[model samples]
Structure formats: structure tokens, C-alpha cells
Target: MSYLKCSGMCQLIGGLLLLLLAGCSAGESKFLAGNLNAVNHTSAAINHFSVNGYGGGNVSPFGDGGGMCCVMLPRQWLPGLKLKVEWETDPNPNVRLPALGTDAYRAAYAKHKANYQQHSTIVDLPSYETESLCSLKVHFLSCNQIKLTTACMAYGQPGYPIKEPQVMKEPAVCPK
Candidate 1:
């Protein structure tokens, strides 16, 4: 009876170890090359988004030697998907007055109200501007709508207001 119990315990431990190793290997292989059906949203306002899978070339900013951040999209989804990027303009050193009735003007007025009552002085400053930097329009040739399983990076920077992937059956409509 004692020998049987010991053998059973060993078998249990060995099976668990095998399962753990298999899980790790499966996860690693999934990201190597496959269909990607998930989208990683890094922002609360839907400003930033990424997909799993590899890009054709080296395009990842954080990639070590190769392009690890490359994401592959199905040929069908490309028809309506688009990527738009905007960048903040360089800051101006000179201070300027805020436009009246604007949020900034109201804020500054509130802060300096007491000072102005005593010293009769007003101060205003300008804020940096953001402009559209680039836009990428993607188009795919295939008409079939199918899910793609793709690989994702092992580790990546998490964006604010992260969102889970939402699967849509119909094609995406672009915003005007």
C-alpha cells in the first residue's frame, strides 16, 4: 500500500511538470507566426492601437535586433482599416496671452484674480499645439471575412485605458 501511494504521487507530480512545460512552449510558438484576431488598445480615448503578429520588416521602435513589433493583418480587414498619427508641435519659449473665454484664460483669470485686484497685473501663457503627422490607409485584396490567429510580443508597454479585443463581423467604417 505504501509503495503504491508513493508511485501515484510521483506520477501526479510528473504530469504537472509536463503540462507546465507544454503550456509555455505553446504560448511561445503561437506568437512566432499565425493569424492575429486581437487588437490591443493602449488608450482610453481610442487614440492608440496595436495588433499581434509580425511586420514584414524592421519597424518596431523597441525591437532588439529584428522587428519584433510587427503585426500581420488579414487581407480582408485591410480594406477599411486605417491608422492616423498626430504629434505635438515644438514648444514656443515666448509667453503669450490666452484667448478670452477659453478654458486657459478662465483658469489664469481665477488664479490671478486676487493679484490683479491688488497689483492690477495680468499674466498669460501659450500652450503647445498638436498637429496631424501622418495617416496610413490599408487595403486588402481578399473579400472573405475570416479570423486570423497571430502572435503577440512576450512583453510590451501597456497603454492607458487598455481595452479587450472586440470581434466585429462586418467591415469597419472609417470616420469622416
Candidate 2:
């Protein structure tokens, strides 16, 4: 009877340890699976705006060899991933509805430019994991409609790099 009790206790402890190990491995795998799809989607969206008399540009990622999985032990448990996107339109040939002259267009352009600058600065600061920054600069060149220039950046992740601004046919709209 003593021998049987000891065996059962050992077996229970071993099973618990195995269960714990499995849980840890699962968590690590989840962390390894970063948001690559999100990056691809962003790239596609930027590419879509490449045409239509718009210029697009992007920046490369920080490190090489794709995105790092477990940069730090704590990261393995709680990954510190980030994605930042910024966009702006040119002031020439305003696209806003009801084209406004040089002065009005310039004012609107300045406003948007300031807004973009502010957003860019804000994103640079440390914040939450999942955050986005989008800015739109629309100029009214005609009675109704405006021209747009968009710029974006995707950073923090290993594989994903900041993308160049794409010439979107439509006005710049930030992704949700």
C-alpha cells in the first residue's frame, strides 16, 4: 500500500509538470506568431495609392532576419509589438470640394501639415503596443474635391518596415 501511494503521487506531479510545460510552449508560440498579416495589409493599402499621380515612400525595418520572436524572456511571455502609420497629402492642386484659392488652400494645407507633424511626434513617444497615427492633408483646388498625398510608417516589429507613401486615388483615410 505505501509503495502504491508513492507511485500515484509521483505520477500526479509528473502529469502536472507536463501540463505546465505545454501551457508555456503554447504561450510562446502565440507570441511568436506576430501580426505579419497586418503588415501585409498595410503594404497593400499603400501600394494601391502608388498610381494616380501620387508618390509613395517607406523606411526599412530596424533589424534584419525577420521579426524577432523572443527578444527578451519577458517579451516571450508578453511581446512588445508596435505598428505606426502616418499619411499626408500634397498641397498642390487641392482636391477638397469647392476649390479654394492659394490663400485658403495654404491655410488648410498648413493646418493639416501641423496636424501631421503633431501626430508624428506623438507616435514617437512610448505608448501602448497597438497604436496607429494617420494624417490627411487635403487642398481644395476646385469647387468640390481636393488632391491628396499620403505617407505611412510601420515599425517596432522585426520583419515589417515603414512603407513609402502611395498615391491613393481617394483621399487619405486612416485604417481602423
Give the clash count for each candidate. Answer: 10, 30
Give the runs in model 2 whose Cα sits over 4 Å from its true position: 1-6, 28-121, 124-176
Q: Give lDDT tens digits, candidate 1, residues 1-176.
A: 67556577799999999999999877622212222122312111111222321232211111212223344323233234433222111112122548998999888656544332100111111111212111111111111111222212222235312122322232365332
Considering every candidate listed, which one attains the maximal lDDT? 2
Cα error of candidate 1 at position 97, Å: 18
- Residue-wise C-alpha lDDT for candidate 2, range 1-176, written one tens digit per residue: 67556577799999999999999877633221221111121111111111122222421111111221212111222334332333332322223532466777778766654532111111121222432223222221211222322123333334423332232233365333
Candidate 2, TM-score vs. the true structure? 0.20
What TM-score, to 2 decimals, does candidate 1 have?
0.21
Per-residue lDDT, model 1, residue 155, is 22
Using all chains and alpha carbons, the TM-scores for the candidates as numbered come to: 0.21, 0.20
